[model samples]
Target: MNTTINMTGNWKPKLMIIGTLLGAGVGLVTASLLARAAEEGGDLELNGGDLLKTALGVVTTMRSVAALGAGIG
Candidate 1:
């Protein structure tokens, strides 16, 4: 009386896993790029207030993106 969709003999599950891995790979690459940009100091230097603003903006953007992905935005 098992009531589960048996995915053992399906290619769909494999494809889904591959898709997830690809998305994760892309995100990692993007993070690396952002780190490189920060390290190289590509013209984003700011003072106290400006630095706080920039930090807030980046954090807000990340949160918004996560929210949208979670369908909560």
Candidate 2:
């Protein structure tokens, strides 16, 4: 009976941690930028169309990133 666990090829958790940190960093930067813009512009108003466009752009970017390395050897 083998009770030992293999530590090799365990990359998913590492990748997830890195991805989470990167996502948090990006969110912080985005929030900071928005705050600065709002402060300088007096008021920040986002219409429905603007929000929809931004959502679509983010989805497209995420899809593109997810497709990376799909065709690589």
Candidate 3:
């Protein structure tokens, strides 16, 4: 009888877990900042323009992050 273990195949789940944790951490920090801003400004209202701008910024940031390793060797 013979058995083999593929160590290289383990990276996918590890990468996924790291990505999930990082994303969650970022989300928590962003939420904390927003909450602090709202509390200090005493304004809980956000208009459409504000939302659109924030969405665009987030998309741009994600694009930049996605391109991180594209030029690496």
Write the residue-wise lDDT of candidate 1 on 1-73 in tens digits: 4344455777687868976898699779967887888889876444799769867986898799679656686
TM, every model = 0.45, 0.77, 0.69
TM-score of 2: 0.77
| Candidate whose TM-score is highest | 2
Tens digits of per-residue lDDT for model 2 on 1-73? Answer: 4344355897779878988999899889988999999999989988999889988988987788777634322
lDDT order, best first, reads 3, 2, 1
Estimate every model's Cα lDDT from 0 to 1: 0.74, 0.81, 0.81
- In candidate 1, stretches whose alpha carbon ends up further than 4 angstroms from where it belongs are 1-8, 42-73
The digit string of per-residue lDDT tens for model 3 on 1-73 reads: 4444355868779878998999899999989999999999998788999999989998988788677635322
TM-score for model 3? Answer: 0.69
What are the RMSD figures for all models against the true structure? 9.2, 8.2, 8.1
Q: Candidate 3 — what's its lDDT?
A: 0.81
Candidate 2, residue 34: lDDT: 90
